[model samples]
Target chain A: MSTGAKKRIMREYGECMSDTPPGMKITFDEQNMTEWEILLDGPEQSVYAGGHFKLKLTFPNEYPFKPPVVSFKTKIYHPNVSNDDKGSMCLGLLRPEEWKPPNKVVAVLRLIQTLLIEPNPDDAIEPSIANEYKENRKEFDKTAKDWVKRYAK
Target chain B: MDPAGQHRDMMYCHECHDEWYRDEHGLTCPECGSDFTEIIEEDHDPRDHDDDDDDSMPDLEDHHPQHPLHHHDPFQPADDPEEGDISRLQWRQVGPGRFSVTGTVYRTVSPHGQGRDDGGANALGGFASILNNMIGGAARGQPAPEDAVHRFSYTSSARLAPRDAINPQAHMEPVDEMTNVLVGLMATFGEAPGGPNAQHPHGHPPHANGPGGGQMPFHPILALLNGMRPGNGTMGDFVYSQEGLDRIISQLMEQTQSSNAPGPASQQEIDALVRKPVTTEMLGSEGRADCSICMEEVNIGEEVTELPCHHWFHHPCVAAWLAEHDTCPHCRQGISKHERPSNTADGNTGASGVNNHGQMPGSFAMGDGPANDATLVQENWENSGSSQQDSSSGGIGDRIRRGLFGPPHR
Candidate 1:
């Protein structure tokens, strides 16, 4: 009955999951107060298509005041995500400016989904991947798809 | 003179101006009344010594004898009748009229005449020797002749006589002695003494016959009798008696006991002593809206937990609140877990919605509890695995693993 930010987030998650895509889910860690995991389906026709990318969201004690750390658990190749690690997406939702106390878990999840569709090469976590995407988009897509299929299920 | 007047005048003496008789040759002066002696002069021849009148013959050669006695009748001058000439053997009248006579006694060559050849030096020496002996005796602490005179004769005479010798009534008994003998004598003559009861003389008793009459109380006797009684208890034996000592000790004990007994505890009415409820202004200073555990606005009358960090919240809220976190809900400053139930692990778990019946997180509520929880679990699992792998590979494996694994997979 006492609804704080975490309660509101849980409520919003249940509401959002009612219309969620098949095989994709988001839930909070049972043991931890601030960690969350999300299973996302790769968008159709993209290099990550047919892949299930897992992402971990870890919030600090000062939640909403500061952004959570979002990283991918499924391997992928992208300019904004490190290819050496599994699905390590570096998104703006986790950025200091984009985070505010009013921003909810649903909003953060939506932001992560948007990052999957269009990764920002300008503020990329992997510079080599960003360069490959800039010089040869075809080769970058190919490497990203192959890694997603190999690591992400 | 008229005969009667002359007779009256003849009755008074000339010297005394009183009546007197003058039948003899001696006449008395009327004012001074002194008897005058008749004067007579005799002629003496140098060869008139007669054996029959040896006593009347003068020793002319030894004119200055050791003891010379002269006799003269009253009011008559000495028979010698010498003049005032220092060189001649003459008598001079020194007293008034002819009462005294004096003449040239003698002339001495030297007062101390030991001998003519010694020039009186021996005599002077003898006198000095006697004076020295007297002074030396005194200096040596010897008793002077005057010391015996003072101790014996003079002191014996100076000693006071007994009272009986000095007091007229000392022979009579003190209690029976009459104070006024004259009054007693008058009573004996059938005349009553003048006093308050003198008019009722027959009805009155004798003056010294009443109880304690004419006899004063003896001060020393009264003092001795008063001292014999135990009224003051000043006597050494009375003061040190067991009964007196016990009473004193008991009195002292009673005084001490009464003084030491604690006074009664006054009824302290519970009015201002009771604590008042915390106000909104007291809670609002920390910028906290509601109780962190209950998620309810802390009311004015509600008791609250106050942390040393100047944060306040409802008592139950903070107790359940601090159990989840070991710091202030608003400020995140460290607070002891033992201080509140909320700070303990159980309370924290319950407040974090870990219980079967999920409750909303208080101040530490996160966005999307399920999603946040899944993320935390995945991250922890991956971090734990990576750390284990890194440790198994040794120090060099950490850098190589970081180059291979990059940031934690999650």
Candidate 2:
């Protein structure tokens, strides 16, 4: 029996393929449903605007029940995202307790967009960006946009 | 990635083509005595991202942020100076029993630009405007409070149908457009999305997809419970009746009681959660801290539950949350990640004992069954064994060689 996840994922895939979310495009092997490569366009209003960020979303077998592991594939300067080999962004809903099984990949995509627009300094993975974001807005925006141009582009 | 696979602890051996639970059995292939094996974490395809590396990537550690002041450990000096509110949560009660929970949630979707101004405004905006004519239901002993009443009963379809059915708000809310599409798949298989509720393992496909909505499944029990009401008094009336409330309370109590058993989270595991007494310093300088559930500010000294993953939340919020699921709300990493294997005595379940009808519990006879599956193996063994026997068996050839060289060495 394909659990709720299999059917739900197919539905998500169809909807996303049919109506791609703003600034987000997903590509996955038809046979391999669990791992998907997402091409994310930076929010227009943000410093990272005009950049296309590459991200990989990998769902566990117990998806919905468990949050998908989303990581940045393209390098970009963001406060919430870890700038490392892992490139894992510490988003909240993907957090175990916050992850309602009903939540979809679409919501996660929305979250990434929101994070790009307004990075939270409190729970930042990259504190320097957060500090700069809090104390020096100009430098932060310039560096973020610079990284967007240099790497995310 | 193998989406269907649940167990991440599996290690596949190439030499013998055997699979071992890496958690139970250490990193060796027991059957063939080989060390070559690949670790698979829940069957996710080995990451292709590891291959791509750009040297231009900035120096990460130098740019990384650090939380230096008041690391927020459960045990800290109580007399620490409070800091500014850095958490992006603004809890504003719009009306009685209704409020817009706006915050920079882990995954969020609120119209942007509400900004930090709402906090100062909400503090002074309550009291006189706390719903001037508050609904008289569930008054909670206090004639009225300055703020809006927030009491509520959480219900799912698995519990009851009737009076709650009249509740347009409750029941059969599709999770998303995708859930609607999946419902079509379920319908093709002929399963009613929620007929008889919990009995349907792979849920009864919700018949009404409508156009779009949250796809949280509706339990069929909602109808059955409502059907039990006397006469044809309508499902709406019965849903709001005291009996309905009683039923919901009883269900809630039963669920809470069940938590003592090995449910989503074990009692011991839940107990291990850090009971950090809410303090001023933890909330920072602003006296507003975000709870894991509501994403609202928790008051100082309000006890919170901290998961092993280090995510903390209001005690009540986390209690209600943990009742449904086990993992830490924020990290998805298990609050109780280390689930003790049931049968630790015989962790190594070998390929040989897989088909045996009544084998000993821990006795996994290795290298017996799979090794003998083909006749080609016997032929090869016989051929190699005979050839080795002729040279090193030391029967006649070794004796002659020893006789010729007997006095030579001396």
State fnat for each of the candidate structures: 0.00, 0.00
Q: Estimate each model's TM-score.
A: 0.28, 0.31
Error of 2 at B330 (Å): 16
Taking the tens digit of each residue's C-alpha lDDT, what string does model 2 give over B300-387?
Answer: 6667776643446656556555666654443233455453221221222453212111111111111222222122122222322332
DockQ of candidate 1, scored on C-alphas against the true complex (2 decimals):
0.01
| Candidate 1 residue-wise lDDT, B233-297, digit = tens | 22221121346545654454445432221121112211112233555444332333444333345
lDDT value, residue A104 of candidate 2: 52
Looking at model 1, residue B50 earns an lDDT score of: 34
Measured on C-alpha atoms, candidate 1 has an lDDT of: 0.38
Interface RMSD per candidate: 21.0, 31.3
Model 1 chain B lowest lDDT segment of ten: B147-156
**Per-residue lDDT of B332 in model 1:** 31
Whole-model Cα lDDT of every candidate shown, in order: 0.38, 0.46
lDDT of 1 at A146: 85
Please give, for residues A1-153, the per-residue lDDT of candidate 2 as tens digits: 134456657766775676666778899887888899999999989888899989999988766556789899899887889989788985555654234443456656766776788776655778887788889999988888899889987
Backbone clash count for every predicted candidate, in the order shown = 38, 30
lDDT of 2 at B284: 33
